[model samples]
Target: MTSKLTLSVFTAPSRPVNGPPAIPAPQGGWTWPPTAATLIAGEREAILVDTVPTVEDSRKLADWIEASGKELTTIYITHGHIDHYLGSSTLVDRFPRARLVATEAVARDIKTEAESGNDRDFYGQMFVDELCSTVIEPEVLADHRLELEGHDVIAVATGQSDVKDSSYIHVPDLSAVIVGDIAYNDVHPTLIGSDHESRLAWIQTLSQIQDLKPSIVVAAHRRSDATNNAEVLADTIAYLQKVDRFLPGNRLQCSSLSR
Candidate 1:
């Protein structure tokens, strides 16, 4: 008999991004959106999708996973964003046996970001003493697939959605999809570097996700109180379409895209 699969999402609370004072500071600082990290489990083994940024947050996530009493077989990153993978080293230290993996493009991007001092100099200020000292970058996922208790968990590459090399995890058995930064719920979509063309691409990707007909959809960034459901797919597409309609001839100024 095939083992039944289960899904759980851990959402981190909104934290400060520590931007310059010129930007309107809400909640005492530039509040970054909350993020979700998912865990897919079976009878004995489990797979983790994405991770938090700060060591404190990752440790909390680790404790949550430990409570499940399941073996973590793999840690899969859906994108290259720092918020999604910076705390990987913390998890790695906790679960030494679990392998960290991502697509070739995401892996390359992560390696570059890990080696570069730029991220440390930037996010370091936001997280302050909470940031992890080391980053354990993911290796290239050779097959683009992960298995938990014999169930197939496939990774779908969705070109660009807020960032390059974006992807989502499709758990067919669970009828679920964990979209990293591809869909936003109750939180404004980040379009800092996005252009009209990229917004259109993002819309197309959202539509494709709709075609997958996932019963459950997990957005990487969402309101702390929001529920995970397929409805976010349409909402994300609509948000992108609305933004695309107002694209100016020139690149969108940072001020214009501010959340």
Candidate 2:
């Protein structure tokens, strides 16, 4: 039997201002950019990966999914980062039948982070004008495979990429991978979530993905001009390489360099 798996990427680009203080308007008065909530849809049902940070962004994602004419069966979280799963609660409320699934480690990470109140203290203070809130840790999926309309979606559980307990969704039939914050295109990698040793490990993760020979790679956050291709992977590797070389010597930081 032939498998038909269709993919779509919905992004909420960053905004200039939010919350009470608005993050001090940045260096150039520019605000931080937005993130993505990727949708992997079959003919009859669909599975979503991750969610944006703010309630508004996530609610919009829920609306978009609701109108897609497919039953939302699963919301597969690749990781437990705030920007990745913060919107899951809103999504679950919107589509009650859609089960929120993640790795056991990821679930624990989500719970731990939620308990730390970073969702409110960090994201809430940075994004929403009012203090944004979050909830739900998602049901832990025992296995790594997702049967999306009978197509085998393999899970690549990467231990540390940007954050702990990261994973990627690989659709073999389509030669496509939904990489959640593992790789970025035409944007600076967040040095805050990753450091020297972890960045090296992330390079290896990207190498493993390269070995898959996927035709398309979806980054959780990306620039509008970037495309899903090997060039993006090369760009990410190059960025990390530069960081590895210069960061310890204090050559550069998160500033955008010539790419």
Candidate 3:
């Protein structure tokens, strides 16, 4: 078996972002950190995992994939968050021959987010007009596996992480897993919907990934200063643990102070 498939990472580098009024802008202010997309390529074919949020970002990703010189077979979406698939229209249009596919649950969530206006209403300030006006639908995968150069790339349903119905990709031939937003490298994990109970679920999700024992863990969103390795999984687990400890108290303290 050929265990030498190549993997490349493309990050949509950060742009300046001013926190909304409630959050209040500090001295230097915040920046929207980069988003990641991965390409697992072989001699003749490839599989792309996830995508960036904006129209322009998707165009760049298309160009990057074109430069890889491998026929893009399928574009895999790991989960349902809009940002992960917002650029779908552009990608689909660009790669007309490539199929856009995801787990059934995730495909449903994409439709949910698109119709709910949650992504457009909140993320508009950061991405502005970059968000697409149309939705690019994806087909639900009949099986949890994607073939890259004829090797089986497995998709394991993690149940929940930052969002419900999240999953990570396991490439057994390469000893790697392309984890969506379940784990972060240096960047903070988003916990808006998280609480004590859901976080425990996330911890279990992390365990599911660890059980695979992958060496090269591909984080869906990452910072250049960080690394792609199993260690980041432990770090993400620790961050969620801290959130469980301090976040609630901090929220309560703020609530009390406001009152």
Report the number of the highest-lDDT candidate. 1
Give the alpha carbon lDDT tens digit for every residue of 1-259 in model 2.
4547788878876754442342344464445555777788888889898887766777788889988888889898888777788778788888899988888888888888777886567665555343237668777788888898788877778877777668888988888888887888777777664567787887888888899888988888786556877666777888888888876534233442111
Off by over 4 Å in 1: 255-259
How accurate locally, in lDDT, is each candidate?
Answer: 0.85, 0.76, 0.79
Taking the tens digit of each residue's C-alpha lDDT, what string does model 3 give over 94-165? 778899888888888887776777777777765533666566768888788887756888877768888878
Give the candidate number with the greatest TM-score. Answer: 1
TM-score of every model?
A: 0.94, 0.88, 0.90
* Separate clash counts for every candidate: 0, 3, 0
lDDT tens per residue, model 1, 102-213:
9988998888887886777777876644777677778888788887777899988769898867999999998999998999988898877788778788888899999989
Off by over 4 Å in 2: 1-3, 17-28, 128-132, 249-259
Error of 3 at 251 (Å): 7.8
What local lDDT does model 1 show for residue 230?
92
10 residues in a row with least lDDT, candidate 2: 250-259
Candidate order, TM-score descending: 1, 3, 2
Query: Distance (Å) between predicted and true CA of 133, model 1?
Result: 2.9
